[model samples]
Target: MAAHMKEQTVKVKTRPDYSKQLITDIRWLLWAVTIGGLLLAAYCIHNGYVGSLPWLSAMVGLPWTAHGVVCSFYLNMAKSDHKEGGITFESAKANSFVADETNTEGPMG
Candidate 1:
């Protein structure tokens, strides 16, 4: 027997202006630790504190490269979808109160 599938449209979430929220979600602690690790690695190597410890400097490289790749993917997606007439945050917020259905009151006596 053969099976059939029906096509459905998906509402993809897109943010018109994402910079502010992105800035708010940054992990400062992670950055500090990564940079501190690299600096410590340099210090140890400079002081001739040799061992495999210097390799810690590369600890941050992979994650940063991965982050760049992921960000690039999102940017490309946004560029490709730039022609879409998506609603902006401010407009969505303003329109949210119009049909909230919070007060489904019965007919007044």
Candidate 2:
């Protein structure tokens, strides 16, 4: 006779979702960099040093790049929200004024 062996199932714990927190942190860091870059750009422009063109361009570009990244993040969030059945302003408005089928009174009556 063969002995029967019992198998045990172990449940694995999942890590909490940190994607939103990570995105928020990244946005904050980018905004900080954008502010710092704009300030540096202003300083570079005011000083008008001959060889500072590269530095000025880099400083100016940094803020624009940061802005673009933040905007892209927002766009991605909106797209994901729409895909996930999240309600939007337009959807809310359309859903708000659903005609009541049971109503028999006319507007003139």
Candidate 3:
């Protein structure tokens, strides 16, 4: 007679999603820099150090530029997630039935 052998499976752990936290941190940092830059610019203008106005403006604008870039990245991520069958806002809209000129009777029809 042959001996019976037992098999066992091991479980793996997955890392927690930190994207939301990271974005929140980035948002706070951007707000801080923008507000601080504005205050510094105002101080410089008050003391007649107008020569640094342009630089200050650029400093303040940096956060807005970074926000735009972050938005683009988020858009791309949403697109990729939709393609992967993830439930995103775009996917929900796509799956919903809406009566439009192109679809006279909607999805049911």
Candidate 4:
């Protein structure tokens, strides 16, 4: 009776998406930089390094922290709202890329 039954097989993709992995790694890097910068700033203040050179740590760390914050903001803004279905293209972006009559500057008048 078992011989009369047929067997079925399923195939799966062998290749992995490296781009997705790279994106995830980059996100982790942003978090690391933010935390590292804050720690470095704290260390500099605690050890009185600011007495000799006040702006060194701030110059180095603040930009990195700001960069991480910017990245996080964009990331959050980009997340799709599954519950709400999705965002409309017009509402998602404040400005449209489509050309309008106002932009008249050209290579030749």
TM-score of 3: 0.56
Candidate 4, superposed: residue stretches over 4 Å from native: 1-16, 51-109
By summed lDDT, the worst window of 10 consecutive residues in model 3 runs over: 100-109
Task: Give the Å error, residue 94, model 3.
Answer: 19
Clashing pairs in 2: none
Candidate 3 per-residue C-alpha lDDT over 1-109 given as tens digits, one digit per residue, 9 for 90 to 100: 3367556544444332365455667788889989999899888878888463777778878777987788688667756766646665455578673533332332112
As a whole number from 0 to 100, the lDDT of residue 106 in candidate 4 is 36
When 1 and 4 are scored with lDDT, the better candidate is 1
User: Model 1: per-residue lDDT, tens digit, 17-103?
Assistant: 454245324345448768888788889889998578635746766556655665677666555544434333344456762643433
lDDT of 3 at 68: 77
Q: Which regions of candidate 3 deviate over 4 angstroms?
A: 1-16, 84-109
The all-Cα superposition gives candidate 4 an RMSD in Å to the true structure of: 15.5
* Number of the top-ranking candidate, with TM-score as the measure: 3
Instruction: Note the residue pairs that clash in candidate 3.
Output: none
lDDT of 4 at 68: 69
TM-score of each: 0.43, 0.37, 0.56, 0.35
Span of ten consecutive residues with least summed lDDT in model 4? 100-109
